[model samples]
Target: MPATPPDDPRPWSIFLIFLRLGLTSFGGPVAHLGYFRQEFVSRRRWLSEAAYAELIAIAQFMPGAASSKVGMAIGLSQAGYRGALAACLGFTLPSALLLMAFALGLAGQGDALASGALHGLKIVAAAIVAQAVWGMARSLCPDTPRRVLMLGAAAVALLVPGAVGQLAAILGAGLVGVVVLDTKAQTQAEALPVAISRRAGALWLVLFALLMVGLPLLAHVADSPLLSLFEVFYRTGALVFGGGHVMLPLLQAELVPDGWLSNDLFLAGYGATQAVPGPLFTFAAFLGTAIAGVLGGLLCLVAIFAPSFLLLVGVLPFWVRLRTRAHLQAALAGVNAGVVGLLLATLYQPVGTSAVGSLLDLVLVLLALVMLMAGKLPPWLVVVTGALIGWLVL
Candidate 1:
């Protein structure tokens, strides 16, 4: 059984917590998820392990930055709309501000980030994600069938390599669960305190559809640069199924050819975004600032992330209710297993492959993992120490 939440935390408290996470939660989206699981699930006990897995499953099915969406969902579940906004702003602002400043020539981190410290940060990402995989696999994929499903999902994701493959794996797992997994065998899942009604959810969905379709048409008709910019980012947010990394090619192709930003500038912002400690979607802030200014950066940042908020708010109410159904619970079990698999695949490709190049890097990762799992040290501490170690030794 999960620990009971003490009380309804105020939005301010949620903001402060998420703000700290935004500052320290390095290593991109997969690593962000790991950090979140540690903070909210393991340490804070705001949600049960099962509930957290369900949130990941839902976020993976959505079309935006999965970690950011998960954060929003956690906020919304705990403290309603205000909490959701608070979480989004708190988690996104640090990197968005940093990237926007970099875009505007107010700060320079490129040369420094190219050093060994960055490599250590990458290693930290690997260790954190490895810990997440280890914990989630034990809890979510306990049985042989679900474990098989987990491995199969990982194989498919590794083989296929993209948003399409990821979505297919989760969807296929859900279908398989509905067929083969026994609902009676599944454990009871705690209900999420998602605060929207079905009618409200439907309205939000309708609004999402309207904006998704209407924005493009409005941009075309008005022939305004700002509207066009908003439309492009909004559409990108609505359409991209994977995480922030997947948005790179789409944004590059759209903005570069359209003359909104030079490819060099776009790539530079991307590199800076990686060096920061929040969602890679904050790259929008960089592009917007380069094109306009601070206001433009804020505009583009909100525009890109707006759809994610809408989709999560719209979908989660019904998702909360549906997951409790016996049949859906079975399917969710399979989806949960698939979510673990997706994380496993991510830990390998980008996290492990990028970080673990040498024997020393591998040793660093193993040491960090031990600290997280056995020593029970906080992830942020490990991350900070890893960067220092890399700066000194690597």
Candidate 2:
């Protein structure tokens, strides 16, 4: 695809298209990219391969849900801020609504059938995530230097764990990138414009910063439930990387420890998300339903994802300068390596170990890998197959 197709650039049209995509798209965040490539790039001709790849690069380095961030950025490039909002809403809504129903549906029942379904869904999630880690590792750490960085990042992240450790690993990798990759990034940064004006970007950035700083203070002083809710979810959005898969551990630690929600409910909702289409970040909506209600679900959804949207919008107008610098590109290369390692480590811990327990699980996982890597089955199809296999065997 070379450019946005000549037809409708209308925001509602963008919204409607994404809405359909959201309803149909499945697998996980990485798989969402595949769906995006098929729809927006291959079918719709909305972006060039290079532009899509750049969005992926940017999403990988940023906090919050990476898939959602890329969606918003694509919308921004095509139409503007309204486009961004439309894209996000259309993409996010299907899963959000489904998750909300899952939350409500689970209120009384916790039966054998439910347990069987949940287990099956988890197996599917494991299989999908395994493919993601494998694919990312090969592409992101193709060279020896980057391979070394990936290993180093995995070691640290495995040892340290949690949001603090994740932040440190990513930040440290960027600095290491400066030293290890290239010394010639002293080239002057270029300026580029986007759908949003520089002034608007600056303003959005200031708001992001203000919320980051002031939300905590407001939580401390007033002790308001609304402020507290926003603070917790907002902080999670601002800190974690990777996407919904990475978001899981951080959110579990934040909400479960405080008794804000229960372990049973959390795990159930998590399994439920595996069955849904669109971004797994819609997992937020399920949590919201448990804690606050329907409105809470909506509020939490907004809070947890708002940082990503803000950061993408705030930076996009100036992203040309950053993307243009060769030295910076080298640094990003290291960061990308670190990102792969993080995913690799995560795959082993929560995603891999948690799902595969016996020989049956092992066989299923291998089958999943083959189908994803070689068989060329769509992820949702693979997911359905995995679920059926899980129900039968696991």
Candidate 3:
């Protein structure tokens, strides 16, 4: 049983606690989840284990930043709207401020060491992503057909290498699941209670869509197309389901074609993001910095993540009610499967193409995979090993 809600009239304490959490939690989403479980479930006894698990599922399924969404949900569970707001501010500010500071520093200097360090970081990124895919596949693709879908998606991504390819694979896999796969067991899966409200839901949906459509147009009108770049990324963060990897293509589509950043630069920054200890979404800081300057990085951070906060506040009141519906559960299962496929697809292109440049690179990736799958090393350690290998070999 969960503890009774604390009536601590001082919401400021909640803000400070999460603020400290945001600053100190250094691992990626998985690590952050562990931290939340410890703090909210074990320490405070604020929510039941089941409730915590349900929130994680919803956050993972909804997209944007998975850990951030989870943090927001935890906040809402404690002190309502004010609690959620405080938690978000606390969790996000630390990383955002740090990333902005880093961007500012990088903007002024063009060092050979930085370039070399980034090269190693790219290899680490590839290793970490590949590890994530393998781990997810073991859990999500237990059957032969699902494995086929995974391989098929990877092949399609390699062959087509674009947004269309990714979308087609996701849609195709979902259709197959809905039409052919046996969902009887899935149908019987327990549903989580919905806690968000209709008004909030409508507001979130509307704001998400408006930002998606309006930001680019506003950027065009303002004569600084880069603002459009920020807007597109912002919307992508808000609307994308699954997780950070799912947002990769959407981000690529927006930035690569528009000439905001070169492929090498974008890939390099992505690689570096893995090494940095925070939300993978903070990669937006790199993109923002590349586009305008420190301010651009800050704007991109706000634009990309603002919608996530809004959506959490808007939808959380009803999550408990909505999460339990059969159709919604089925849809989420399909979406989860699609997410696995998407990650598999991603591995071949930017992740595979950029990192695996030689036989040595292949060897390093294989070793990293083995460490991740068999040894069960934490991702950050794997990242460090990959970087060390790159530094020594590449």
Candidate 4:
């Protein structure tokens, strides 16, 4: 048998490719992942479908932003450490810069317009989340058992409003999936290639863990509660196992009780995040700015997203090896199913209850959902329409 040729080792080309993705990839993490699959897997043929799937699996398992981690893994696999850094920096910088600019613009604005716009944005966000729940249910809840698990999780979440409940529901669903779902059909899964050095991986992990633990403490000592708020929010971003939206409850826990920002302000920032074209994590920038200032905004962006970069760098080399194990894959599948259920539950409570306050709000939400699902309009367009409806009605 002929020996298989080694994969391409060039760094510069990969850097440029990811740089483009970073600049133009929008519509939050899910949209960005779609773009990535189009550009890297389908268009460029840099990775096989199996390889891409494995990377996604690994990303979904780890804490932090899944899309960002997947992008970093792709870059690392293609061109080593520099490639990973370039990919992460390129993808994250555009949104961070834009959000920073937005914060600056909002700094001197009167409260009324900002408040109204934020209200409209929240309705749109609620609609978008509803669409997400519907789509996820269609895909993840393949059978009656899964649907029951999902509904049960949602019901539990409705009864108990907190991250702990969400976590419990996810874990419970995973246990159910593992115990009830058939695993006899499981087949061998291929491993993706790792490109980073082992030493580099260890270093990255250490750095990520240390920063997450220390940043908040440092902020506390500085006598700046805003700085501490930024640190906590950022740490949530860095440590969360899902994407930007998954970080919502974690952020709410940190902010709502502390009185750093009211529930309304936090929700407003979240709504505005949906209006933006980049990662939903940029909402942190808005919240940080609202809480502290430009410095807070900057700090929040860095703290929240920094761990994603580190995890990508740390795990990319080993993830391919790690994912091929059947037990691990099964565990991940259960976790992902749980994540879907949790997202579904979230759609009903804070998002649905807060946005659908009035008859007009309900109408706007339905219209937005129609535009998004039936009309097949882009999310940004639906957002604009929602805003117009909100302005007229509210």
Candidate 5:
């Protein structure tokens, strides 16, 4: 592993900072990036802006919760592996605990106010995703070729309509980029703070692969419900590309069919996830609690997040060295455009169709969009206001 950066802070301090973010950071992954930029880059000065943006790039290119992985990267750079752990725990636990408590309280209950709040939260998701789609499209799909790729990806995602479709869209876009995009331009780059040894990075990667392959086999051989649960969540965490919002369809496919949870509960938990302040993956905690209990919640939380931790540790050491490659850049460009498309498709389906049941809900979504885009309101406030409105009107 690499030596800790000279300016490394105490792991406890890192934990506290992330914990505060966990309590207050309310928007989805895209918004989390802004929160991170404000906290680490502008305020804390943990790393240079370029270094921070580099970390964001790594997180975006990877297959997990982008903001969570970026946080992990930041922590890892500051105080080595332990700092990474502290950061993740601090950022994830508050939301996980809140969602778990909500799950336990919500079980077997059918309160209208609660239902209305969830409905409003779902509407908030629609607005948040719409904002993300708009913002990312303006940036990532700026050119004609990229714009075409984005639209094609959206079409594929809508038609295929599942994990298979998503994967196909990403892969196809990447291939197209390899053939069409020119990515030879280079910029002055700063080194990432961490310098974990390639050997150690390899080990972390091997462990990730082992669990990825072995978990399902072990679950199959053991035929244990717990193992099955772990495998399902682990796989989901390992495959989702864009961020937390994009994980929705994959989670639905994995859990709903197995009778692990109902569609209503799933969407409700997702909506509740937005209400809480943290990575969207914390929805796993609610699902696990619904399935079993506190223990199950912990299990799912760890299982779902484990891959992100492993992947970041594995890739961080190599990122600075390999980031300048032309093919890699081209592929990442394609994947990013494809991700925008996936998010666009996602907005209309499970998020929009499920939440906007009437003209009023549609109006609510528009209002929420305006709140986020034009009003400059913090998402947490919007979420709270939405819940109240939903409680009264929905």
Candidate 6:
């Protein structure tokens, strides 16, 4: 059903495309997923709908930044590891550059006007995620069983709270799915083939595990800033569940007490981050630059994102084969439902609460959502508008 030819898009092409995507793509991971769909599936036709959906399935099932994992999977499926790096780097570069500039004294702790604009940016984030929730619910939670599963998952997420709650909700939903959903439904005729082999995937997984465990111990004993930086960011990337704004607290806790960076500088960088496009993980660039300059920023970037890609590479070869099984498919069904619920819970708590404090804020959220769903304005344009409104009103 796709319009493109069979051959893979050139790796350089993938980089250039993602580079542009990185520069302009705003909002957080959920919105990033939506943006990815626009660029890769709808506009570029880099992947078919089913292919994109399956890739999302895998990315959600893995740990780390969901959007980053999805981007890496796209590259891995298309043109091996090089494509993977290219996509990640391209998507990450703009924010990294801006955040690093902030660290280097080129930017400021934004004034009140800037703060209001950032608040507006936050509202745009909420709107983007709301749209994501609606679309994902329609596509991924279509059936009653899955819909029920999603609601249940959301309740559990709200009740339990935190990373542990999120992981449990997803895992439990997978188990529940195995019992209820139909696994024998037909799959797409042509699933995208991954370039990684099972053995290679396993090797990468082993390396990832080794580093996760080893880096912390080394940081504690060796007294190396590099090791500490790697360990702190790596651990946060590995352990955090939702993987967007939620990372902020965990990151602040890790670096602030140690005096690696000051609280004012850290908060300033975070505010500035709202104006830039790409993953929230690029906050690492700011931290890295504050601690050790541009190279530090780049190193932190690698340390933070590496685990997600490694896990994806490690799991895919095996996941593809196993998910085809009826039981596994059923479990995946539950997991998908649970993820939807988790997103809903997130919307209410962090996304909704943080952004919509007053009547004006609520109006902005509604307007942004309508603009997005009406399909006339692109997301970036809506985001810019929201920022302007925030500056003028909030």
- Compare the candidates by lDDT and give the number of the best one: 5
* Model 6 TM-score on a 0 to 1 scale: 0.70
Give the candidate number with the greatest TM-score: 5
Q: Work out how many backbone clashes candidate 2 has.
A: 0
Give the whole-model CA lDDT for all candidates, comma-separated.
0.78, 0.75, 0.69, 0.70, 0.83, 0.77
Using Cα atoms with residue i matched to residue i, what is each candidate's TM-score against the true structure?
0.64, 0.80, 0.84, 0.83, 0.88, 0.70
- Candidate 1 deviant stretches above 4 angstroms: 6-8, 106-190, 320-394
User: Which one wins by lDDT: 1 or 5?
Assistant: 5
How much lDDT does candidate 5 score? 0.83
- Cα lDDT tens digits for candidate 1, 1-394: 4576665567998999899999998766878999999988888788889888888877875678789999998888778899999899899998888887777663355445435665776677677667767877897788988999999988887887765677677777778888888875324435666768889999999999999899989999999888888988887787555456546545654787678865445544554565678887898998999888888898899999999999998887677455457777677778778767877887786567667888988998899899888997765578668768877887
Q: Superpose all Cα atoms of candidate 4 onto the true structure and report the RMSD in Å to 1 decimal.
A: 3.9
Native RMSD of candidate 5 (Å): 3.1
Which residue runs does candidate 2 get wrong by more than 4 Å? 1-8, 27-61, 64-67, 77-79, 111-114, 183-193, 222-229, 240-244, 256-274, 357-364, 385-394
Task: Give lDDT tens digits, candidate 2, residues 1-394.
Answer: 3654866867898899889989988767777899888887788777877778778877875677888888887787678889889999999999999899877776545455355545566666666667766777787677788888888887777898766666667777767887888534333422212467778889998999999999999999998876688788898888665457656666765677678786546655776676678888888899988788888889889999899998888877777666557767677677777766776676676666766778877777788778878997776576667657656765
* Model 6 regions more than 4 Å off: 1-80, 98-107, 110-115, 185-196, 212-300
Residue-wise C-alpha lDDT for candidate 4, range 37-125, written one tens digit per residue? 89777767777777777777667767787787887787776677677776766677666666666666655664654546656777888
How many residue pairs collide in each prediction?
0, 0, 16, 2, 0, 0
Q: Per lDDT, what order, best first? A: 5, 1, 6, 2, 4, 3
Q: Which pairs, if any, clash in model 1?
A: none
